[model samples]
Target: MPFLQDPPRLTNAYLADPLLRELVARALPGALGEVEPELEHLGELAAGRLFAQQAVERLLEPRIEHWDAWGRRVDHIELTPLWREAATLAARHGLVATAYERRHGPASRVHQLALVHVLEPSLDVYACPLAMTDGAARALLDAGNAALVERALPRLTSREPARMWTSGQWMTERIGGSDVSLTETVARRDGDDWRLFGTKWFSSATTAEMALALARPEGAPAGSRGLALFYLETRNEDGTTNGVLVNRLKDKLGTRKLPTAELTLDGARAVPVAGLSGGVRAIAPMLTVTRTWNAVAAVAGMQRALALARDYARRRAAFGAPLAEKPLHADTLAGLEAEREGAFLLAFRAAALLGASEAGVASDAEQLALRAVTPLAKLTTGKQAVAIASEALECFGGAGYVEDTGLPRLLRDAQVLPIWEGTTNVLALDVLRALAGEGVGEALAAEVNAHLAAARDPALRPAIEAARAALARAEAWLAAAAGPAREAGARRLALTLGRTLELALLAAHAQWCLDHGRGPRALAAARRLARHGIDLVAEEPGAEELELLTGPSADGGAR
Candidate 1:
């Protein structure tokens, strides 16, 4: 045989990740014994059979069957073999039910998200529907509508494959993307029920059993306040479309396996989630839940990419020696690994806070910290995922770019993390809005300091000081800036806070590892991340200078 390089193979997602194992063990010492078996099993499936199946299977996108032979319109979507199988696996694994089961109490969220981290990357974004399903379940429970809660909550949280249900969040329309205040979808009273009439421009998971949407009531006031959140089944009792017209499936850049559609709702029957108004406020719970999923999924993607790249480095030889033996190559992988560790801790911390809040075990300061950390984690990890994935691709040389090797999908899928749920700019503004609440800034500072206080290692002192200094600079900038200046620097300020917190959390974990005789790997990670720099705030440019740089020039020529 010719001298050919052996391809990389995954042994076990759960076993391969020491960071995940240690974090869970430290955070949920009491629950690790309970959740370990399931986590280990899912990790095997994700790396073994699922990985092999995806490698050999023909890549297929979802297709719609518009009409039958008799001219009867049937908007049926056929999913790929993996997607269909994913639904069953996800249900049996209790990927969405684990949090609601509360078997581990407040730590249940950590357990649930831990399973999601291992399983999502292998399922080809099947996490899309599961995220919405988890969000809808939380939103419905919070709404407290007796009938809908009774009818939907069980199926949504069910572990049985046959009984489990997924939901679509149909909020985007022709008029608005993130700004739901301009919604034009209208609702008309139909006795006790309501009928919705409008177009949803971007509806993901359209094949879902049901959906939560927003629409303006007839003669109601304008803007988001006029809108009401409503729940509707996608199909009627006869298994026909419930006045919903699936116009067409989107030709997306990534996540092609997912069924995203542009929909026209012609009087689709719906019931109010809470009441006829305040839909924007009512959907807050759903946003918080889904945004956390986004952050977790982002970190998971980064992990997958780095794992493959690291394995490849160990296997491939260049210039008569393995790439892993080369100092520069090893250094590159270390940088990527450090970024991944920071991202993983930041995202999991959000999950921990959420679980504590829901279990009613969190203190007042913790509750306020959760409000700010949710958006920070989402935006920060989302950006990190794209950057890490792109760099990981370069580590593979030419093989990474080849589609047949299945490496390119890592970058393509990661590109969606920053765009979905909410874009970077939009989420940065959300962070500012969170700070507007009473004691939110102080609470966030308290949370960061708590993490920094955990470190006792002398070697980790520099990283701790760097984190504290970066946080102080961010606070000072916020106090000095006002109006347009504050808004203009929102992204830098948000990133500064987010990265500062990540460094602090990593320092604490590194200290834990040192105390437990787990060696200096985590301490090395904290040091590297500090060297990468946490502070992102910069001096704001003058209005005229900014306008000149961004706007059209007076000569109407290219700047």
Candidate 2:
């Protein structure tokens, strides 16, 4: 086998698949062709792992000599050829290529939840680089920041234990993790010399050298706007203390090993990222990429959970027959499949948005859509994946609850996803603004109309009609909505309207492309996904009303 860390610097082969080709052609034309190679690499990694059960059985290296509480030796998983290749190449390229894909491609649902329900908004810790804790935040982002990120990315692809690329997101305080606005950490400016001070509770200052810290600038506002981002690189030449202190680590329900560090900054000097007022907004963008990955990870965990349930159902007999033969069990499997597929399509569409931004050609409408959808992607996907895993575990009956079965870890991992990035409530708020303001409503309606028009499958005709009706419902809602009342009404309408429309659009995209024959595997998968996606959206079915109704006096929408 090749000594590489991941698939070769190749485009994803699936993009060439019939279904994916079709989807790409419809969703993105030239752009679709461009992602082919990258997607192929993703496919290779997935296929290789799927082919070698051992590759996936243990996601991390088990070679290290350690023991769980039960004395179970930590298992060291051998790196797959593709994984190795990816890692090695990432090191050479000074960046982790498709690190997001690595986690998301396999477990999209779980990844979605982490960012949506927990990670993004929770001051419980972990800061997005886009937040207010980096110096020269904008300057660094141009080239230097990208370099550091790229340089550290490959280490993550390797089988090493500690996560790489995630430098520091300081959120502890002498008071408490909550109410960060009361944080006392200070960044004193002395003759161009910036030094950090004050003790932070659960600072985690000891874990990694680099940190995006929030510090008070002597006399400043009392709220969050008074913060700044400092790039505190690990300066300890010998991998030792670097003018920072880690008081202790906290034991938590799920992410126990991830290290909840308590820290102390002792007159530590750091590079200033940007103006103090811009910290929150600056670092907020960083969550954009990572949150997406969290959502992807959630999906991975769910898939693992499903695989476990599927395996058990096929092998274990409950009443003189395999559980798979039972109707209820069969229905459960179908539901899981439906949920998993839906999560995949949603997450993939979000990824496409990221791809567009990277290409430096994203439109205003698309960007706004991305902003709205990313959170939705995180929240909905996370909740679904976690719920699916629970169902799968339930399918296993008694055996699933056992820690030794490994099924439990998937659930635990999934549990952390929604709580990692931004909470569902926060997402709900963000989406409300997106749909109510900006060109989101009109753009979304037009997109929906187009989506319905693209479908060739007669099976979806009724659903398409219903979806149009729903769009009409949404359109009517938007037509009459205004002021604070609009926002309140927009929230509920936004979710179903956005999701239903995007799903239909994505379906039509896949349908048109597959029939036309463009990209291959990616398009083929898109088509498969489109059919399923349309079906899923059809579940909520919408149809345009002939006369159209108005007002916020209706069920969760404009009356």
Candidate 3:
């Protein structure tokens, strides 16, 4: 019997995937000529050294120490070598600093996010803290908190590991899940400083140096309007906890390497980043920044899973032929590729907009489109990651189910995509809200139509028509649906919008390939995605049917 050999290792992500290179070239052709070398280096590191480290450094979870041998209430968290490596790489490469520096103007965001796409999957969940840190920086800048901006921005964006700092987002609490209106955290002023007192549930990246939290002032009105964004450092200069008690680390299903914890504030001192009123509005910039990170991370995970699966297919054999040589296996891989390309197009488009918006170069239409697509991309790509990762795992057969192969971890880690930043349903509601704002839907339709118009390939025609049809249906649904019925079908509508956008982008990429005399990969991806059919035209139910869904069950139980 022939001894089954392991799959060929992917040493360099950029060199391995011509598709990623092509996409970056198409996205920023002029800039790509300059940034290509850096991207290539980053890609090599990701696919080679980082990939090897992840395999060898298995089961590296962060542990929290709440008490010392001497009974000192010292809160210490120990990180694995993988996380340490990720942190060092993040600082050395100016991953966070690049975006803030705006060296490439509007193209800076594109460059930064591209690097993130290559860096994140192998970062051992370092992206979580980095996302929050980026969000915090943008929030501080938008809030125009001069003191906090000067002090925090440097640390947040520093390229030196000793000077760099990660940030935690302490928005979620015991009372509030996604609904910030239910926030019970209280903030009372003591002289010039604000003292926050409450328990924060689900504190991801608990090892960060500081955090951005939402707290309601004592006399402020109720609901989300009363809440204010507060900034707090995790420690004092004396190396003591700043009235912050680390309860315990969460035993999560995935992202176990990440230090997620429950924290209680015994009058933790804080500074207000924005006005006491309209805290949600003040956080708009932060949301824009972080959602883009989530979308990029989702697509990155999908890419990594696909890469591993494709590598495995070449080595594994059945029925006297290699899996890669099997027509059915090829078809499955191509299907996954189509999904990945669609997600990539949608996500990069969002990242580009964010870069433009940050650079103050986005047009009015582009601004509206950015708002609409941020949530759409986040929600869509998040689900796609989990689905694609699961499929990729199956590509390995029995080996994929084995933990030692590092295949199951891809699926486990992908599970966090949908749950992080916001769930699919919550993001759907955000999309609806964006649509409610003037010009968002129109801008989205315009962008999609322009892309569809540019795509001249025969294979893109179906996707073009479907995208147009989906856009029409979305507008109609937005106009007709109201009250609870509108709320009930928000997810369906948001997904339809997201999927249509993806098809439009895929078609556009295919067109780019045609113009550049490239191969059939983009066209193939476009055709497959189009054939999948855009899920845009769900039949709206009548009042009774709507009630059946939203109302109580036969036993009078709530959903």
Best by lDDT: 1
- Give the Å error, residue 475, model 2: 5.6
Q: Write down the TM-score of every candidate.
A: 0.98, 0.67, 0.96
Tens digits of per-residue lDDT, candidate 1, 1-559, equal 8757778878799989999899789877987777788889989999999888777763778999999889999988999889999999989989999999998889889999999999998998999899999999999998999999999999999999999999999999998999999998999998987999999999988999999999999999998889999999999999989989999999987888889999999999999999999998878899899999999999999999998888888999999899999999999999989989999999999999999999999999999999999999999999999999999999989888889988888898899899888999999999998898899999999999999999988999999999999999998998888989889999999999999999999999999999998889999999999999989895557888778778867556945
Q: Name the Cα RMSD for model 2.
A: 10.8
lDDT values of the candidates?
A: 0.92, 0.52, 0.87
Lowest lDDT sum, 10 consecutive residues, model 2, at 116-125
Model 2 residue 554 CA deviation in Å: 26
lDDT (10s digit) by residue, model 3, range 182-263 = 9898999999889999999999978899998889999999999999988899899998899889999998888888889999
Model 3, stretches more than 4 Å misplaced?
1-8, 541-559
Q: How much is the lDDT of residue 163 in candidate 1? A: 97
